[model samples]
Target chain A: MPEISYRQAIKDALAEEIERDENVVVIGEEVAQYNGAYKVTEGLLERYGPKRIVDAPISEAGFIGMGIGASMLGVRPVMELMFWSFAYVAWDQIINNASSVRYMSGGLINVPIVIRGPANGGTNVGATHSHTPENLIANMPGLKVVCPATPYDAKGLMKSAIRDNDPVYVMESTLLYGTTGEVPEEEYVIPLGKADIKREGTDVTIVCHGPSVSVAMTAAQILKEEHDIDAEVLDLRSIRPLDEEAIITSVKKTNRAVLVEENRPFCGVDAQIAYTIQNKAFDYLDAPIQRVSTIDAPAIYSPAVEPEQLPKAANVVEKVLSIM
Target chain B: MVGFYREMVRIRRFEERSLRVYQQGKIGGFLHLYIGQESIAVACASLMGDHDHMITAYRNHGHALAVGMSMNECMAELLGKATGCSKGKGGSMHFFAPDKNYWGGHGIVGGQIPLGVGLAYGVKYKDQKGSAMAFMGDGAINQGAVHEAYNLAALWDLPAIFIIENNGYSMGTSQERSSSHPKEGLAARAEGYGMAWEIINGESLFAIRDGVGRAIKRAHEESKPTILEIHTYRYQGHSVADANAKKYRTKEEIDDYRKNHDPLNVYRLFLLDQKIMSEDEMKEIDGEAKQEAEVAAQFADESEFPTVESITEDVYWEADNPDKRTSEGRLFFND
Candidate 1:
């Protein structure tokens, strides 16, 4: 095993899948000669050539829908959006077509595709550029969503998403691209809808995913060091096919829960997790569950205020304290 | 010519029955009847080879039947029955048969255009000598997704034939008001994308055969894309719910199209002139088509609705097939 950045881990998974499967192709804007907007596709175009690494024109609705369409055929396309905010233009293609085509066609067709890109706030890219859509995507039944914070989960989930028979939306964070974690060289795939207990404890449960996983870990450290509360940190590697069992188990042990995410409080992923915890672990609860979420604003432009808009460790600690 | 005539008749009869049941409150959802534009889909289906694929908008009963789908299944779909082609999951708007390479009857206006181009991309990817026909109405011509698909098809040299079935009106809005016309009308917009463009008289089955045949040939031989404006008409409302089908346009206009330019009548006259079939045989074929449609409606009426327990089925491939699903946790959250 070796430590690698989340960014490098994604490229490694793509290169392996492309080699293993001839049908696998990377289609998106700037993914070829430009090596992707985030450089996650660097050296892929040269390695696989133009057929496998397609550089689509800057048309999200066109290329994204085209990817879904191709997936209906035999092509397993790994489409990249420069930013998930751009996916709104192809919202019909994703929600109406990719998500419903299989179910609508009586399971005759399945869109075996992966739409990956950085989807988070606090990057200073104004309202139009920044978006956290894991909650919105997970809400759709036919689609699967993954939000990986660690390099290990990044590689494993990316590989699995490509292999999955249904459409999988991989929500990567630009802020976590440089973060490193242990990744093995052997081929492996982390199943969707699984949770990992990052740091176990018994005082209170801090369940989170994607960028908020790190926030929960930091909050756990703070709760242990100062407040003398051994907070458990549970990272949901995948959002849909959500790991409610892990959350309930953790909440049952701790008897208190604090859910967190970088999405709006209303109808967010944490909202679902909160409901599940109350329903599945009601008797085990010592207090009403609490959660720290991105403020209700969809996107905030001010760099100074954007940091506060994200779910912070201080906010998580406070939420935990209130529930404890 | 008689085979083409039979397919057109089957589609028209199927649509009439679907419309009847729809008006009677038996059929649910939108029913976009392909009454006047029978020849376009039938002609395209007749010209299809093993590798050629076809997709269309919601007005798709014509294309589905033309591509060899059974009327019983299509009628069952309209009735929302368990044995429907889409197992009742897709109503009138979405019918698919991947086995026949008929992509779908997509609901959105121009959404299927890009998907059609992607189907063409697959043809090229797999080294198959085929093309994809993406049919739309004049309304879809102005959609942003359509232009985007055009650019991709032309740029990538994907074998996509973007066919605009330009019936006179887009819903209640006439074509003259809905879209702007340049020097050569909507199809000529393909020139902007550096693609080939043409207009075809949609009523004449012979014209569709020659025009669409050449376009499909170009797609297969040269790996090129074409935009064909097949000028057609619709005898019914945009959907059964559209109250102003007759109100939006004069009865005289509808009568004029029905009397003079009806695709079935026009092709029937052409076939009679060429002695393709006897008048007696033509009458027999029309009777058989009506009988088949009646039987299909009866079948739909007797068929069962999808089971209440099966509501959660087909939403996820992994959830349906537990053996292959590697993911843990709840794929479904609710009861």
Candidate 2:
């Protein structure tokens, strides 16, 4: 086993995949010379050279579409967006082209392209720079969306996304990039659309993913040590092709559920999870499904104003206690 | 030359028949006709090799036919029949024939430009001699994606040809109104990216074939990308639903172009004057085209829709893979 930061885990996956396959190339804005805007791709350029580690201009639509086009032939391109919010500029390429090509082509062509970038909001990057669009992207049928909350999941899922035949969108958190976790040194891949239970409990199930998983874990700890209430924490690593079985199974065991996420409450990922739990685990539930999510509004600019708009551990704890 | 004229005639007839079906309520969704813009697709597609790739925007019926997609499959797709080229999943705006290396008929205006560049990048990366051609309209020229794609294609020197089918109007807005410098047209924008560019008369099949042939050769031999502005026109309105085209342009202008500048008529006259084919031979080809279009319409009408069970299919490649889990049993209400 090896302890590495989440950022290092992702870098490790890129290096390993590039070594294993000649077709694997990383392309995006500042991914090569600048070593990535968030430094998640640090040291990759020197290891892989200019061909494999391509530095693209600040053109999300163009580079991302090129990645898709290249994938259609034989190359497996891992496209990095400086921020997931910038995907709006390339929405037609991502949503219309990358996501629909496989289905539209009758499976004759598969876009094995991985679009990975930071999609979390709590960094006070303002509305334009900060967006958790996993929910929006998950709405498309031809795409596989994954949001990894830990270093272990980051490495495993990145490897899987690169190898997968379909277009996969890896949503990372700017805040969790430096967090360390124990990951196996051996080659491994955490299957997409699977959930990982971070903490075990029986009283209530707090389901979360991405950066909000840590928030739910903190709430679980407080619930146990302070309130003497056992709260189980479930981390949904992949959003689309969602692990509904794991979600329903956990809710059925705990009999009470709280959905936590950093996205907007309206039509967010948590909203879909809550609906699934209520419909599947309705008979097992003892209380209504509660959710802890960002307030329905644009991301605020100031650090002080941002916290109030975002969901915290206290919100998860309050939701869990209210159900209990 | 007769073969080229026949191909153009085939595309024109197919499009006219498609319009008839669309008006008859048989073909559903949007239908973009290539009645007046057949020479560009016919000529450019004729220049493509077996390994080359082609992609274009929604005005794609002509490209599909020009790239050798069977009339029956194209018509079936427009009719939303499962026997279609895209298996009925993609209608008029999203036709695909990957077997022929035709990537797609993208609906988004400028969306296919970068994807085309990427296809060329793959060819270069694989050390293949093949190249890719991406077609857009005057409307898509202003899209930021097109500019980004141009810069990357030029910077990387990928083997790609970007053809701007300047059809006078983008949907309803005239190029003069949409473009910043209408007189210079989109060809001027290519100089900024340092890419070789030319504007050819899209009505003349020989001019189009020669210009695009040269660009494709440069792409294959020199690994260079070129921006080709082909000035063409669309006889019909933007889409099938744009019945009131007169609101934007005058009927007299439309009639003048239809009579004087139709690509099919221009090429037909060229071939006949050059003694490429006799009047009887030309009429025979025209009749065969009309008959083929009718047969395609019949095939589409006889085809069935995709079954309900397959609604979830093709969403992902691995339907039975153990790792792939969908939101199936988790929310099932009915036992």
Candidate 3:
């Protein structure tokens, strides 16, 4: 195992999938010669030819839909939506075709594709570039949504998504690209619909995913060190087929829960996690499920507002403290 | 090529029955019939093998049936029955039969263009030899997605047959009014993509069959994408429910097209001239089609409605937990 940044982990997973499966292809705006908008696809076009590492014109619906069709025909395409906010333009393709292809076709065709991109508010990207995919695609049954908090999870989960026989939405965070974690050097895949318990505790469960998972872990450390409160942390690697069992078991043990997400409070992933805790682990509840989330506002370019718009470790700790 | 006449008959009956169902309020949503465009789908589909796939816009009843979807499932879909191809969730505008390799009857204009390209890419990836026949209306050529898909298809040399059903109108706004250069709709744009192109009369079954055969073969064999502009017409308005416009064109224009260019009549006349079948046999085929349409309609009328549970089915491919987990574990605390 070796420590790598979340960005390097994604690049490694893509390179591995492309190397292992000739049928696997990557396409998106700025994904080719430029490596990627975020360099997630660095050194791919040179490794595979331009045909496999496609540089699609800026047409999300067009290229993304094309990826869906290619998947139907047997090509496993990994498409990039650039940013989660711009995914709206390709809703027709993702929602109507990509998500419904299997259902509409009576399960005859599998849209074994991955639409990956950076999501969540951060670093002065403004309203157009800042958004989360929790409510947007979580309800869509045919799509599998995953967001990896660390490099290890990013590589493993991405490999699994590319190999799975269904469409997957891989939400990356713009802010966490430099963050590093230990990753296995050998080929491996983390199954979807599974949760990783980052830390174990009996006082409270702080569940989060993607960039916010790191935030939750940091907050858990402070809770344990300063308050002597051991807070359990659950990383929901996949959002769609949410690992309810993992969250419920953690809540049952802790008796109190604090759901953490970087998305806005309204219709956010935290809301869903909190709801699940109450329903499945109601008897074990010691207090209401507290949520650590960004305020309901468009991400502002100002550093002042950006900090407020994103969930910080301080916020997570404070929310857990209030609930406790 | 396996079942040309049979497919033609099935589609004619399917479209006619669909019209009847629409009249009776059995079929809902936008219902674009492929009555006159049958030859285009049939001739082109006949040239394709199982390795090939097809994708099209909402005028897809003929394509679905031609590609091997059962007439009963199609009709049931039109009637919104539980047994419909889409499990009764999708109506006419959303008919999709992936098992048959028919991608969808996509409602969004030019939405399937990219998906079609992707399917062709997939075919090549599987080490299979074939092209995806992506059918779009003349109206769809103006859509930005069509241009994007075409450029990528040509650039990648993905096995794709970008077929434009140049029916001369975009839902009443004739190509003349809608497009700057109507005569060379998508074909003119093909040059920019650096791809070879062909134009054929959609009503001429021979031309359609030959042209599509060449396109599919060139794509599969040469791995080069080609654009075939099939000059066609839609007998009805955009959908079944639209009134045939009194001002769109002259009555004479409509009459001439009806008399001389009816694909079914043209094919029948050619068949008679060639002695492929007798006049009496043609009449019998027509009668059989009408009877078949009646039976399909009857089946659809008697089919059961999808249960409440069906709302959750088909959304995913999981063997168990068909209802797609409804309740999210969360609480709403109002301030």
True-contact fraction per candidate equals 0.80, 0.64, 0.54
Between prediction 1 and prediction 3, the one with superior lDDT is: 1
TM-score of chain A of each: 0.98, 0.98, 0.97
TM-score ranking of the models = 1, 2, 3
Scored by DockQ, the top model is 1
Regions more than 4 Å wrong, model 2 = B320-335
Q: What TM-score did chain B of candidate 1 earn?
A: 0.98
Q: TM-score, chain B only, every model?
A: 0.98, 0.94, 0.92
Poorest 10 consecutive residues by lDDT, candidate 2 chain B: B326-335
Question: How close is every model to the real structure, measured as TM-score?
Answer: 0.99, 0.96, 0.91
Candidate 2: how close is chain B to the reference, as a TM-score?
0.94
Per-residue CA lDDT of model 1 for A1-324, tens digit only, reads: 799999999999999999999999999999999998899999999999999999999888998888888899989999999999999999989788889989989999989989999998888888888888999999899999999999999999999999999999999999988899899989899989899999989999888999899999999999999999999999998999888889888888889988899888899988888888888889999999887888887677888888988889999989888876
Give per-residue CA lDDT, model 2, range A81-193, as digits (tens): 98999999999889988878887866677888999999988888899988999989988878888999999999999998898888889999889998999999999988787
Q: Cα miss at A300, model 2 (Å)?
A: 2.3
**Candidate that scores best on TM-score:** 1
* Each candidate's DockQ: 0.87, 0.58, 0.39
Over B1-335, each residue of candidate 3 has an lDDT whose tens digit, in order, gives 21466568778877877887788877777789887788898987777787888889889889988887777888888888987887677778777876667788787899889899988878877778878889899889888878888988887788999999987788888877777653555587788888989989877888888888888888878888999998877777788667765468677876777799978778877877888888787677778777877887888889998897666556655432335422222111111
Residue B214 in candidate 3 has what lDDT? 87
- lDDT (C-alpha) at residue A98 in model 1: 89
